[model samples]
Target: MNNLNTLIADYFKDSIYLLIENAIDIHNNAINKPNDIYLSGKLMAYVEVLSLLQMQAQAFSIPLESLKLDKFEAEKDLLSSRIISKEEIIKT
Candidate 1:
């Protein structure tokens, strides 16, 4: 189940990025003047879709962030210990 959720989240993220790239490359290039080209209705719709996906992904990632924080703290502790021991050896 977790793997499926991760797969879905990754897919959503990829889709959102591709949609943004397409909007910038295709629609944004259609205008001769730089400021004249605006987001078309289709682009706006894609943005809305992206927003919804982002919200869902954030919700799903809350616990993942907590897990990452725990791992980072453990790594820091290990590095701190190693550094202290090396400094002590150098001093001796």
Candidate 2:
């Protein structure tokens, strides 16, 4: 049970990381190419990711208010600095 809890906690953490990374990537790309179709596409992708993350948090019983994007991104940045790559998430 302890192992399972640890795994789930890690999974939740990774999910938040991927969401922030993707959002940042999309935002950066959109800024670099503000005149192309890529801007809208990336923006939409980021929004969709936020929606999905919210749903996942709800499913995992995490409080919605506790999982706001700003808080999640800050937490992810700290967690990311300790981790090597996003590939670790695929293990679960």
State which candidate has the highest lDDT: 2
lDDT for residue 27 in candidate 2, whole number 0-100: 56
- Taking the tens digit of each residue's C-alpha lDDT, what string does model 2 give over 1-92? 99998887678666766776666555555655667686657666666666677667778887755443334433243223243233432222
TM-score of candidate 1 against the unseen true structure: 0.39
* Local distance difference test values of all predictions, in order: 0.41, 0.56
| Colliding residue pairs in candidate 2 | none
User: Which candidate's TM-score is highest?
Assistant: 2
lDDT of 1 at 30: 36
| Candidate 1, superposed: residue stretches over 4 Å from native | 30-39, 51-92
